[model samples]
Target: MLEDHRMSDISVAVLCREAGVSRTYYYHHFQSYADIIYQENIMSVVQYMRQLPDQGIITTTTMFTRYFELAAQSRDTQLTLVKVGLESSLIHSFESAFEYLVKNDLVVKAHPSRIGKKYWTEFLAGAVVNMAVRWLQTGMGETPAQMGRFVSNFVGLTE
Candidate 1:
């Protein structure tokens, strides 16, 4: 199969030539390319999130560290997410993760002397999404352990 071949047209013919597998065998494995991508890419995100500790149970540093840890594990899917245009769901997932942090209080709530607590949550969540997108575009830049320190400093995560 040509590297430039459209995955949207990765039919039985393509798979057959690429893997030396018959059409029937391909069907035995995957219903369609999208089906495989859904089962593998999307579901893996949910699984990875499930594996993450609830924010209440861990330190703020651990929370952000685990964020990158999960992302590193799913780097391919993260890139596939950008390549395949999953923006809305990606935003939703980011918001959901942010909410988890807020509800679990892993991040510091903004005091009245500073920004509103809601703003802090939104800011931190958006910052996390930005970090994630950058990581997908390039790489995580630092170790997950180091990422934890960066996150702690960035979000003022001390309790």
Candidate 2:
């Protein structure tokens, strides 16, 4: 429903009707419309990240590319989310997911100081999310691979 209508314009009734679900069911599962949208965005990123191999500079590039690809595919929804102040929730979701990778030792050979690691994790996640949002806002003039390389290089992810 978010893809079909602006976030500001969508109501619970309209969404429930369009989704063919009862308002009770929707309310039972989602706290609000923003929650549903946030969960959807987070799940999409999580699913893509799960398909990637363990973390490394190359893997980071792949992750960014996949994120951009998803954003490009769901440009309208992303734009609406941004417009409705839900972009931070989406970014926080990504940040938490990336932090999980780091905490689980999936990030091979990343030996930064504890404080540095925390800062870098937040920085990288924010960069990727902001860049993806910008790309979508600008009509995604660059291909995913192109933006991927640009991000990788910008972050000095190359060996």
Candidate 3:
């Protein structure tokens, strides 16, 4: 449905018809089409993160690059979400996932004793989310490797 309709003024009836599911079943599972989109976006990020190996500057760069690649693959769905004003949910999902990874030591980073880990995680997550949104908004002009390098430089990740 998204590939064909692109979420511009899509309705529950149309979605249900496309999926060949009853409206009752669709409503039972999803509150709205936006909810479905949000869950799919979150699931994609979490699944990718889960598959990432260990933690280090290199791993971090790989994760960022892989995430950008994934986003590039689903650019259409993402753009639709942006058009429908659900971009914040997408950003929040990534921010939450990244924060969890940071807190659990899944992503390597040094934390200052003066500031809490949560604060550092939130700061990093916000920066990354903003960069990602800008990248998507601008048609992902940079390759994943370029984006990874830019993020690595911004975060002071060294070899």
Candidate 4:
């Protein structure tokens, strides 16, 4: 699996053989390795986020803590994602996911600033995803709880 090898070192043949599936089956389910990775990680997070209570106060700290906790649970997958040069794709996925939350009113507005809702959500998503990428790049020295607090504080996203 990915635990023992770099993503670049694993080809479709190796993956299909290990999973006991044909190349056709693999192609039927996924476009590529990156697609599998994206679905398994980012999509799971998005699905979790979608289930969050849309009617609550949902503190920024709570939101981020849950986010980072989920990310931490998938630490290896995330690191591999960055290692495979999919950081931009990861960012795009998170941004799009965040936009979905906004459109669905799953999250409260951080502030009533001059910024438009769409741009404001983009700004927030960009900041959070950038922090996550940096955290992964620098070895994730901080715990998920710590990261949650740090990001919330840094963004002035207090309660």
The candidate that achieves the highest lDDT relative to the unseen native structure: 2
Tens-digit lDDT track for model 3 on 1-159?
Answer: 654565666787888887899999988999877688778878888776766764443356776777777677777767766666677766777777776765676665533341244466556666776777788889789997788778767877533
TM-score of each: 0.56, 0.76, 0.74, 0.73
Q: Give per-residue lDDT, candidate 2, residue 4.
A: 57
Question: Which one wins by lDDT: 2 or 4?
Answer: 2
Residue lDDT tens for model 4, 86-118: 666566666666666556555555664622555
Residue 1 error, candidate 1, Å: 15
CA RMSD per model (angstroms): 6.1, 3.2, 3.5, 3.2
Candidate 4 shows a clash count of 0
Measured on C-alpha atoms, candidate 1 has an lDDT of 0.63
Candidate 4: clashing pairs of residues = none
Candidate 1 collision pairs: none
Best of the two (1, 4) by lDDT: 4
Clash tally, candidates in order: 0, 0, 0, 0
Q: Kindly list the per-residue Cα lDDT of model 1 for residues 47-80, writing each as its tens digit.
A: 6457666644556676667777777887766666
TM-score, cand. 3 vs. native: 0.74
Residue range 1-159, candidate 2, lDDT tens digits: 554566778888988998899999998999987678678867876776766665443355676677677778778877877876778876877787777766665543323453245478778878888998998888788999889778877887642
Q: Rate the local accuracy (lDDT) of all candidates.
A: 0.63, 0.74, 0.70, 0.71
